[model samples]
Target: MRKLVCVAAMLSLGVTQVTFSADLAGAKDHPLVSRFRGADAVGYGQADFGNARLPSGANGKHTDAAGRLTDIVYRAPPGKRAAEVFENYRQALAGAGFAISWQCGPGTRDDGCGGFRFAGDLADPVIATLKGDSSEMIKLLDATNNNVSYLIATLVKNGQTSTVALMVSQDDERPTGVLLRVIDAAPMAQGQVTVDAAAMAKGLAAEGKITLYGLHFATDSATLTPDSKQTLDEMAKALKAAPALKVYIVGHTDNTGALAHNEKLSQDRAAAVVKALTTTYGIAANRLAAKGLASYSPVAANTSEPGKAKNRRVEMVAQ
Candidate 1:
């Protein structure tokens, strides 16, 4: 079993980037005010709580600029409290006209993990809302990689509203990671979280079990055949109908190659299915987990070519 790494230190980097429909010209302003152009003429004020290293040479330096109510950059070191950093920014923005409409950070779960091993603390994203009642919702974006963090706040004053955001990031050369964006919790005029409940029902139909079918592979290799696309198409249909339903996509192999190699090949095949689902069908990043089972979980005999073909398959178990 792959032991879970300690992630307590990841709490310090809790925040993600906020992208606009168009790049805001005043994004670098001291207080960071952004305007949604054209018919979307609404302007927003922002605050970033990411523990990213800024030019301050220390943590919690507040600077004032045009459009920015207050800009505070905090570089919290290991063994330090990020709440202290957030308090400083709170004070600065308070001096201005903004008050905390919402705030979010790592929870008790992040306490014992120690320090972060990845960037952005990207795995943990929390949203606090002052709806009719004050409530907080925390979401995890990626499980395999848990180093990214982000937070977003929406403050309202009379008829005007502004949004503040912060994100901490670390460099990972490969573009395979999770990203979270917080949407304001407003009463829906129609839909329930824009979720198609019927679709969700279809997705839950195959919750924990994986099914199989016979398919040929390349000689001496685990590479899938062109005919395998038919099975993949069925999997894609199930995913598309229920967009929010996430699954643990697994690949299994027959006992032909060495166990280690078979395991690796199975894992690769599983991930390939995930890529096709996400990129080709526009599935969200947080909804897929990929793994390889090797030949240990085979359902058929390796004695016959027909039986072995039945053992090589891609299986999905809803997470």
Candidate 2:
């Protein structure tokens, strides 16, 4: 339901000349921010629930957030300067009652907004979110020049806040490019986006267990988040479908913290699931068991954040 407030005036897309002709397939403007006229959307990606770590101000600080995330990469019309493009976005956010939390670039009165260091910090994290054929467009941010400008702006309305990050950078040889990442604070729409009971049953029947990534918990916590309701609903339905089946709710964690702490944390999580099924959904407590693997049975390596995420999951195993 969050929409970018409309700018009072359309941004001037200086000297309209084409560099890229087509937008990426299935790519479109995010509802919050309209595209700059004549710009080509070379890269785009969105997730129902995700995190984006964007800078807030100078010196490696960030406006890290998790919510409905969208990444939009654009190549400005030929003859358009990166400074001009950045100004347009700045005004748009300002018109929408947003506050510029951090801005940098020689062209932005911030010759040292940690350009060399910030670029190194943000480039990879930003690029990893891009899923377009022209992902190389992000390389423009690699430069530190008069044409480079970055801004992280935020808006708060009715007790909720959302974040938008804008960066305009042009490599010495490439056209001016813009990366717009927006994180709209929202609870994941439940019942609509999770695996259904039938699929959960199918997976369990085939593999003797089903890994449940949809069931989310805070870092090192046993309490399920609100977005996890739909997955838990499906789990309850699966239990109802087979009344006599014995199941084990097993939890696993990545090797991040102390061994004793992780072991207890994982056990508490598995117990929470069993508690939910037995109390909330009226399943028989005797028919279920709970256990914690505590990094001992990792499905993936624990070397990367993505891998650690994969290892921290709940599995429903058949007895």
Candidate 3:
């Protein structure tokens, strides 16, 4: 069950469907630093963190019912120094089998970068432990309204892992270190699970005006799971709510299938999604464009089943 949930999330990441063009090794620093500069600073901690400090937060949103925050955080200074911290964190967590989910805050939503929103759905607790000596799992609690973000790095080791989430607020404004407080108190879910849409798009918006819909899926398969449809429905509401903005439907997949097959699948699925939007949901097709990617690009790994799942996915890029 744990493996299935992990596979589902990896599939949601789009590892099985599309490929990437740019090598994202150095894309983490600037965007994260920028986000740190823009948020409200509640407290400051030592810039140099050799040891992991547990964070705490209220259980209402950023935590589970038991009040534990299950997210992983890595702090670094601005500029190259921060990247070094990121690298160290990457190595440590990767040594344990995790994949970093590269993310950026709202201020840096350029092409190829994941925009900031809530850390709600991105947080996946250990549904079931597999091939590990440790039973402890990592999760990012709710930061729906707290506007700080960074280049999030997730890791998966032997089907058991934690994410190395890196964030930098604009001007280096940091949040209260309440993440650990919640983690210590969170009650475990009963089974291996995938994050849902409410958690994924809690605070997401488009063009600083329209609220964006985040519909994520695994690569290759165009079948919209219940979670994927929920996310799309949320966006559909946003489209209905704000009728002026146009959206581009971007389709992506992992590096597993043949390039031609991947491109076709991405295109067909994207067009299908647009079709659903226009014909079924009443959104205009003119508001959408289908872009297909063959398996040359990736935000995670193509080596493992979980990583490949993360690689295959579709996203709505802003117009």
- Among these predictions, the greatest TM-score belongs to 2
* Candidate 1 lDDT by residue in tens digits, 1-319: 1111111111122333334343233322222232111111112233321111211111223211112132212222233233333344444444445444433333222321223322223222122211111110122222223333333344444444444444332222322111222222221121112223344345458446455342335654555566656555666666777777778877888898699888888888777777766786677768899889988887867764444655776667788
TM-score preference between candidates 2 and 3, better one: 2
Off by over 4 Å in 2: 1-21, 107-112, 115-118, 144-146, 158-160, 189-319
- What's the number of clashes in each of the models? 21, 1, 65
What local lDDT does model 3 show for residue 68?
20
Report the C-alpha displacement of residue 42, candidate 2, in angstroms: 0.7
TM-score of candidate 2 to 2 decimals:
0.56
What would the TM-scores of all predictions be? 0.33, 0.56, 0.36
Query: Model 1: which ten-residue window has the lowest total lDDT?
Result: 129-138
Tell me, by lDDT, which candidate is best: 2
- Residue by residue across 1-319, what tens digits does model 2's lDDT show? 1222354332232323223348887677765576677788878788987867777765556655767788888877777777677777787788867888778774422344653343546555666667775346656565545466788887776666668888778767677888888887764443345788999899889999988888888766899888888888999999999888889999999999997898999999999999988888999999899999899999877764456767888999999
Deviating ranges (above 4 Å) for candidate 3? 1-227
RMSD of 3: 19.7
TM-score of 3: 0.36
- Candidate 3: tens digits of C-alpha lDDT, residues 1-319: 0010122233222244221122122112110111122122121122111212211121212211222223222222224233333334334434434444443332321211233233323322221211111111221123333433444333333443333334422222322211111112122321133334343233335223222224443434665545556556666775676577676666777776688888888787777778778887899878778777756557666654444555666666556
Candidate 3: lDDT of 190? 19
Give every collision pair in model 2.
Answer: 4-32
